[model samples]
Target chain A: MAINWFKYSSPASFYSLAGKMIPLFAAAAVILLIMGLYIGFFIAPTDFQQGEAYRIIFIHVPAAWMSMFLYVVMACWAGFGLAFNTRLSSMMATAIAPTGAMFTFLALWTGSLWGKPMWGTWWVWDARLTSELILLFLYIGFMSLQAAIDDPRRADKAGAIIALVGVVNIPIIYFSVQWWNTLHQGASVSVNQAPAMASTMLMGMLIMVFASWMYSIAVILKRVRIIILERESHTTWVAELQKDGVA
Target chain B: MKPRHKKLAMIVAGVAALGVASVLVLDAFQSNLVFFFTPTQVAAKEVPIGKSFRIGGLVTEGSVQREDTSTTVYFSVTDTSHTIPVVYTGILPDLFKEGKGVVAQGKMSDRGIFKADEVLAKHDENYMPPEAAEALERAAKAQKASLSE
Candidate 1:
């Protein structure tokens, strides 16, 4: 069966498709969160050094990964919208920003809590930390720039430019610990090396990562539906849908 | 503005922003990027005397000593080619042990001893932190480069 994927690319069609997907993704997210947290807090062995405090890595590493990954995804969507002038792509970019920012904030806050016990300070100006702080600023800058402009098209173009430029910071953040003498420790899990933690810990962390991924997708879909309504409020189809209580 | 002009404006704006960002990145990398110095750098007089900095490497075997006073501890950090004695007055992190990775932040005395205000052990025993491992590799590379010269 051939499905015309392009049909769903339109905002009106995507709104319904997203509505159908939200509940499934949201359910999976909830289930995975429960399982991941259970395994993370219960099944994973206590560290030989960091003790129970090291358990924070279950949430911290996943949130950190999502923060970086979501930014790249946002930039790609924004770039697509800029190049193709697709309204839905730009709407997706806007929908994703807040979720990405939330994850970034979570990563930093959890990292500070983890640091207080291990590093003896709540924060330090290490290269990794500083670059991550810059990432947070970039997110805020993108949102603020988008909001400041009254025209939606102008806002999308401007926000896209900022998001694209900010992509450079992603590599810097990942490589900061390796490139500089930083107080922040290096990653335990790398492509070329075996993960330093036990198998159970790795499993739990991976599950948590997927949970966060699904959660973001669900939330972004819901937000994008609202954005569609806001942008197309004056259109006949949108008005009909709202009148029929379909929206 | 026409649609064509809008595209041009976006292109120009993106290019300008990227150019500015690249300059900031370069400046940050050059000035604020602190490279880890191995014991070799300390021995070769490469590190500054008065300025506080971090030294990272494996704790030399049989070098950790605890005074009866319990607050002060002594150890030597090494990258195999050289070793620098570190004097720290604090409780050591759980992973601090002989033949393990450590980073000590403090100033160095004229007599070659590191007076550490803080001592940090690596996250695990078997696994060296990537930053510390990379520092060792860099120091070794520099040594090889000098030998070839």
Candidate 2:
């Protein structure tokens, strides 16, 4: 029999469900982080050209990927909220912003560290780099706009509009290396060609990517639960949960 | 505002937002999206004269010359169709080797030479281990030797 898919779409149900999943995801994230870092540092051999400094890719590339990926996910959730007037969808979108921004900041930070010795500068106005910086700003803008609006419903709509608009930057950031003569390099991994990285290096990077994904999911779920509690505080269901000391 | 009227207004606003978003993405792609100009663009005078601009291309083989007493170095950057000689009086990046990609930021001198204040290495996507890199190099040498023989 088909299950009712919308059961958890309600904030009240999703709250406890999210709590149950967060611990599992958080545990997975921690385990994967350790394995990824171990393999990244100990198992992966030194690069022929970049030497030991290239190990930073384990963090940089995965963080960069997640920064973009989370933005898309946020936009999709925000879009669903705008279209269907789903309160849970909007809350999820809002919950995702800080984590996505954090990842974006991490990506830029690690990238500069890697670029300094390899590319000879901490930063440049390259299309890829600038577009990424724009992503960070977009996340900040999304959060700030939401915070500024007193009405949560109106804030969701405004944030959703901006999120949808800023989705265009994702493609520009991904293809900036190809579309322009940017100082940034092209992608190391692509679907059209065999990955250029050594197998062990690729493994470490993939593990780190999964780790980032799990961490983002766990944090977003936790944040969404708190958001539900805050927004539905006046509701009878929330009052019952709070009375029981579970909220 | 009435609930019905507010709902209608929200729908209108959402539609407007979608329109603006589409227009923005289209404009972003269609506009001059170049981050740096190539040697061909520089040769064609597409780059403005005397204004500081970036030029990106492969560092021409066997063209790097270093001054012993100073940090100044001269090299030619080429996109195969055209070339620009660049003079920089600063430290080069680790990846700034002959036949490798580079981007230099500076303006043209009175004699049409590029005097760069900064240089950056443009790396490729390849990220193999040292063993694999050496193996590839050895294979390339063998192929070249066979071609010569």
Candidate 3:
């Protein structure tokens, strides 16, 4: 039998399904994070140069990657919602925004912590950092713009516009190091070139990245279910579910 | 046209307009976006005098100089194509070393010396910053071609 994936596009169906998956992903995220941190700290050799301080890359790089990746995913969902007028897609976009912003802030904070010991400064107006900062603003703007609107549909439309507009910054952030003479170091792990890191370090970083990915999905799914309940509260199904004490 | 078509058209137009506007804004900010200049660019006098900027490259081999009691130190940064002498008065990061990548933030003097306010070393030992690595690769290729000829 084929799985009717499209059926879950409706908010009600996805709400229950995501509720089932959240615990699994949350557990995976926690386990992977612990393993990644352990491997990063204990198993990875001290950088002949940076010593133990380089281990911050395990968290910093993953957070930065997720920030950028989530923005694109958010924009894609927002765009889909705008085009198809789907409530669930808009909810997904909204749900992902706060998490994306959190990761972006984490990336910046960890970068500053790493920088102080290594780069000798807490912060600089480097292209990568600046664009990432702008991304934080975009997320805040999207959420605030939505909150300011009373009607859910209007808020979604407005949020979609902001999300689409901010999509330009994603490429800027990714390519900033390459396009500018930024103090920020270039990527160690890239697609075309071999990783400029030890295998164990690379493995740990990858695991952390996966862990962050799982965490984002689980959190966003949980948030979207709440969004659906709030927006669909007036519907008969929601009332019936509430009466049954399951909503 | 239908109401849905009208909304779709509005979004398309709006995104297009926003895209064009951002492109213009970013183009205006292009020069300012350069995080640092290479030693080669400094040598070519592309950098302005007394204007603070950053220069990034490898610390040229055996070029670090330090005073006996003073915190002042001098080093030369190189991309193999050109080198800029940098004078800085402070403790350098632990990673700062000869033959390693570095970026110094300062100004170029009229006499061609760089007065550095801050000296930052690259991230790690195994990591040659992408810009520094790219420059080295270019220099190596040039050397190979010259030797072959």
**Chain B TM-score (each prediction, in order):** 0.62, 0.75, 0.67
* Per-residue accuracy of model 1 over A23-135 as CA lDDT, tens digit each: 99999999999999999999877765566888898899999999999999999999999999999999999999999999999999999998777766678777788899899
Candidate 1, residues B1-149, lDDT tens digits: the string is 99999999999999999999989978877763464678987888777779998888989999989999678999999999999999999877766778877888999987779999988764542233345456777999999999999
Question: What is model 2's native contact fraction?
Answer: 0.83
Per-candidate interface DockQ score: 0.17, 0.59, 0.31
Which candidate comes out best when scored by TM-score?
Answer: 2
Model 1 residue A230 CA deviation in Å: 1.0
Q: Tell me how far candidate 2 lies from the true structure as C-alpha RMSD in angstroms.
A: 4.8
lDDT of candidate 2 over A154-205, digit per residue (tens): 9999999999999999998998888776778888898898888889999999
Better of 2 and 3 by TM-score: 2
How high is the lDDT of residue A86 in model 2? 99
Cα deviation of B129 in candidate 1 (Å)?
17
* After superposition, candidate 3 runs with Cα above 4 Å error: B1-33, B124-149
